[model samples]
Target: MNIKLIAIGKTDNKDLENLTNIYQSRLGFYINFSIEIIPDIKNVKKLSEEQQKQKEGLLILSKLSATDAVILLDENGKQFDSVGFSSYLQKYMNSGIKQLVFVIGGPYGFSPEMYTKANGKLSLSKMTFSHQMIRLFFIEQLYRGFTILRNEPYHHR
Candidate 1:
């Protein structure tokens, strides 16, 4: 199965983008992987929190294909260890899924419509993180998860 990460806005920090690129390249060796960036909304200062989320949610939903399985990176979502995450990925591959889409929402988080559309939700940590930082963290963990699955030396218990 292919994996796709969809996140709101671009990472402005050069260091973070570079590090994320490294993991993205490493991931390509194991499977089909891609990151799609949804442009940040314009005139954000004019919109209410709910309006912003609603707008972002519409954009997020538009990127999804009918067959894609979406998993939101939500603060309240399920948390799993590295090995368990690998197993989770394995299950999807075994099931013959076409694409697994994981989304990192905007500043105020996802709207109700987004929550309803998601197949499941995953939490990287109980603590909050910047949306841009989460991209790097998630990609690295994904790389680590694949390494664990393949018995590579990159990951250890």
Candidate 2:
């Protein structure tokens, strides 16, 4: 199955972008991994938190197809260790799904409608992280997950 990471905005930090790219390239060897960035909402200063989430939700939903299985990377979602996450990926690969989409929402978080559309929710951590930083962290976790699945030496017990 293919894996897609859909985040709401771009990363301006060059370091973060480069680091994310490193993991992105490594992920390409194991899965069809792609990062789709939905541009940040213009006039965000004029909009309320809820409005921003609503607008971002529309954009996120627009990128999805009916067949894609969406999983939101939410702060309150289920937490898993590296091994468990690898197992999760293994289960999806075994299920014959076409695409596994993971979304990192905007600054304020996901709208109620977006939450409704999600098939599952996964938490990278309980502590808050910048929207941009999460992209890099998630990509690295994905790389680690795949390596663990392949019985590689990347992940340590």
Candidate 3:
């Protein structure tokens, strides 16, 4: 199955970009993984928190196809160990998904619609992380998960 990471906004730090690229290349050996960045919404200053989430949710929903299974990366979502995450990936692939999409929502988090539409929600950590930093962390963990699945040396238990 193809795995796609959809996040709102771009990472401006060159160091982080370099790391993200490194892991993306490593992940290519295991899965067809790609990152799609949604442009930041205009006039964010005038919108309330709820309104902002709604607007962002619309843009996010637009990227999804009827056949895609979407998973939201939410703070209150399920937490998985490395091996368990690999198994999770195994399950999805076994289920014969065409494209499995995971989204890292905007600052205010997902709206009601986005939450309801999601097939699952995953949490990397309980603490708050910068949206940009989460992109790096999740992609690295994805690479680590695939490596662990393949019994590669990149991940140590």
Q: Candidate 1's residue-wise lDDT over 1-157, tens digit each? A: 8999999999999999999999999999999999999999999999999999999999999999989999999999999999999998888889878999999999999999999989999999999999989999999999998999999989864
User: What shift in Å separates residue 75 of candidate 2 from its native position after superposition?
Assistant: 0.7
Which residue pairs collide, candidate 2?
Answer: none
lDDT of 2 by residue, 3-103 (tens): 99999878999999999999999999999999899989999999999999999999999999988899999989999998999998898889888999999
Q: Could you tell me the TM-score of candidate 2?
A: 0.97
Model 1 clashes, total count: 0
For residue 63, what is the lDDT in candidate 1? 95
Q: Give the best candidate by lDDT.
A: 1
Model 3 Cα lDDT, one tens digit per residue, 45-134: 999999999999999999999899999999999999988998998889899989999999999999999998999999999999999899
Task: Please report how far candidate 2 places residue 94 from its true position, in Å.
Answer: 1.2
Can you give the lDDT of residue 17 in candidate 1?
99
